[model samples]
Target: MKRLCTATLLLTMLLSSGCENRPKQYERTQELFGTFVSARIFASDEKTAEAALDAAFRRAAELEQTFSPTIADSELNAVNAAAFSQETAVSEEFSELLGLSLRYSQLSGGAFDCSIGQLIDLWDIGTEQATIPTDEELHRTIHPAAHEVISLQDRSVRFTDERVRLHFGAIAKGYIADEMKEVLQAHGIESGTLSLGGNILTLGCKNEDEPWVIGITDPFAPQEITATLEVRDLSVVTSGRYERYFEENGVTYHHILDPWTGLPSDAGLASATIISQSSVQCDALSTAVFVLGAQEGLALIEGLDGAECVLITDDGTLLQSSGMDAYHVKQVEK
Candidate 1:
């Protein structure tokens, strides 16, 4: 399954015009590697904005082609295929992502593992043929390669078991988003926002005046926002069951499988949103907190510096981390 990509638009006026010039930069869905990408970015001017957006989208597609499991030639997929059998030297991007995944896995106590690739493929959460896999099959397929199989040696890599596969679905976009933010800043484009799917990163502000206002879409009602958070120079990433799923035999199964059970995490929470300075951490922690549940997730966020979380439960309970109440969350009656 995948997270939906949407951005809160900026509506600001050039003071002299006395009218709002809130034009969208580039908003469209295109097939990148094997999946569709909903991409958007905001910039001060149209030409440079479009150029930067094109560069970002191209880079992301390049990464996907290199890392996507659907591509046999992908370095990552090949690496996964050879796991436990041979050693593979990966590109800088793969190494960086793997390193980040390892760090987060340790920090989250294995709740966030990139090694859930086998289980993800077994469930096939995004496809039409999604079903509840047999326990025997799950047990056989669900292997936490993060802890056992995958090993990072300097800039090279090796797998202890061929059965272990790695997937970067959870964190790659955020990393890309962060990179694109840097690209935009380097291009001298200040006061803009870029959203690669749901991993959003903003730099400067809208027109150098207003802080970017990002809407936290309700997991239950994505068309409607649950709250609005004012931000600048930050990234917001969310993990939820609503973005992708399928129903079979009256049972609903979404992505976001737990590493421990190889099943969809039924952590009583419907959604978890994370805000941090690094888009990579924001994206990783969104999935981490989803698996950690509400209380423990809050504790984890509290322990981490410069991290904040908002957890919305299945029963309409809103649990905010210590600093998230400043978002002015407006509770709606059911």
Candidate 2:
């Protein structure tokens, strides 16, 4: 199952001008990748905007089929089915994405893994089959480093264990969102907002006057917000236990699984948001930092260039990266 995002768009003002010199907003949304995929643009012509939006949505659907582990005939599923027994060939795009994900996994020290499908199925969070899991099957699953269990020589993949499977749920949508942005940029759309299931990416500034405003959802109150970030040409992604969970008995189990423990993360954070140029990084880091908690997570962000994060702890402590002052980040008063 896919994780949820806590970042929402707060920009509601649209400029509709009769002047041909001014750009106007055009938006088109569709349900894809198990979430609402919307593409908005500030283009001078509707024809250009519509074509770009169509291309973006089409690319998203194609990627879903390529990456979805649940799809029995998907490339990911094919790899899962064959990689255990023999070296399997993957598409060039899949190979590139897998290598990048492995780097993130290494950077996070196994906090983020693409090879997490087996444990996901065992716990089945966000599904009817979800159940509280113990450490009984933890060893049966794989949480290896980049090259520990899998070999990727010549764009072919082979898993060391039969139980090892790849799941892109934590990163695919964000990658797709980035690709969407590229497609829009190619179509001559410069300014817009993209919300692919809470992976928010802004294309340029709003008329060069202000940056796009992104509202971080309130984990305590879904209808309210906790903070807002003013950013441009950046991706903002948040991950938390606020959604995508199942309650068993009296305890709640979230979908954010810690690969090391094979259990729901106990990092003691309500949510963690990552703001960066790559929505793909924002997507994976959100889950990674949630498992990392505040201290280590903040340090990780600081070490990486062009990245900043805001973490909302379980006890209502708001933590920020050292470079947070670079942006106009505001904490919404309760």
Candidate 3:
């Protein structure tokens, strides 16, 4: 699982695309789960933005901590550990998030299951223990034995099976990005980008001068930008096996795993970036496409309305869904 972010501001923007109308008081807040938050919002004085960012980070950190699986004391971990008897007694926010995850599980046909924690632990993808697990071990730990195992009723959830594990690492960042955007909107700052890690949400156009430009990182080369998308009021999520992985001998193993096989999927594509109204869906879809690989993933993109995708294959082939052609990007030379 990913570490819960405290109120810290990391520079998420690159190659600014040259605009005079940037936010003056853009502030960011930092917190380790709501307490001790540092906020920095941009203003004429750089300190203003820094202060706002600090506050925003703190608020985000609070939420992350509350929902974090890695946090031993978090409510999320408690639920997973069966710390609570009745699902209805859980917090509404947690319940809603769980509901969203379950819906995505059904919608993606288990491709975006949140219950693959056990399988991830087995492979230990980023650790020294990284290696394929035995069939028995894999079967015993990896989750979603059957869709019928998960039940949601009246804003509450229960995983009928005890062995089933859940991991929101696949979709949490995008959801956080969306959540941050909402926070910015509530603050009446409608024209800035909120990016968590690499998941991005463009709130409004940059001062009506230009659409926010978001970059798609080159899967083969980390520092390079394979494409740039211009958009406003939209969320963009990209999933790739490039950054996080472990290489054993001659083989490379990345984090994205196929639920069906309990192994990394060789889905012809190195990366899949999706654009949609909901960051939650974007998060789930990116994982689903990564699992679906190229052909079927592309078909899934085509099947959805108001959804667009750009898929880059392992062989350097870049394909865009029909409606997504407008966001097709030009490689910017570093």
Candidate 4:
């Protein structure tokens, strides 16, 4: 439930060890999906690089129109507006993404839910008019029973309850990033980096031998890097309470809400970073782990194959998944 902001650009690229010659790199940044989207591609010529970047941006824009819940005419908005009224026919792409989101919701035991839009609108964390809703208001408005209401049939969806609403804020960027990578590859651009706010998807590598170095943001001080991860052809997504929050009466409220309580999660976690082959999986898992808390989050990651995560607690302790130690470089002490 991260707000579309400049949170992910904190990922600074580090110099690769023993890498003297770098490929011809072309990079560009644009505003999309309510935040900054940047792409770096290494190609044979400038024209080829620019064309690939253009294609990537175009793909991102298209997906934004399809997935953004805030956009009035978006496919997701259409589904929300039609809840309990009729079965809305969606595109194959939309259906697939929705299906994937539901799968994550099931896996996390509802810790991460796409249908928490009602709760999100109640809190309105990123808006200027955001406020803390009363417990009664939350209880009355919160609708996390999406599993009971939503029915997916091929490329169509129906909600049996009018209260059900869909929001892809948790997983859209990762899916778009993965799509952008595919667009880049189709244009003969093999090596590149797609930074969609907080989701980072590396395309191949900087060179044949050098793995891209990604700096993990310190949840307490996002401007500083608490650790670095060296990865290639993988997605590194970090979900943190510090990414979007508002302070009221000397108390802080973040964007990640617990679906069960319809309030900001008090899961004692500052951030959760997930690394996996699929950006969509990593993106959903990061939020899921953050909401699941440290112990349960660690267990979830351990049980999954090809997934690893580093969970930073509010008290500054770092909890790593069983497979995370191999990619964990240096952890900074507070």
- Best-fitting candidate, scored by TM-score: 2
Report the number of the highest-lDDT candidate: 4
The C-alpha stretches of model 3 lying farther than 4 A from their native spots are 1-55, 83-88, 143-147, 332-334
The sequence of per-residue lDDT tens digits that candidate 4 reaches over residues 60-167 is: 999999998778899888878875688889988899988998888889988888888888988898889889999898878776555656888888898876667888
lDDT of 3 by residue, 282-333 (tens): 8889989988888888888788887788889999788888887566466666
Comparison by TM-score, 2 against 3, better one:
2
Error of 3 at 117 (Å): 1.2
lDDT of each: 0.78, 0.85, 0.71, 0.87
Clashing pairs in 2: none
Candidate 2 has what TM-score? 0.92
Instruction: Pick the winner on lDDT between candidates 2 and 4.
Output: 4
Clashes of each: 4, 0, 53, 0
Clashing pairs in 4: none
Off by over 4 Å in 1: 1-45, 325-328, 331-334
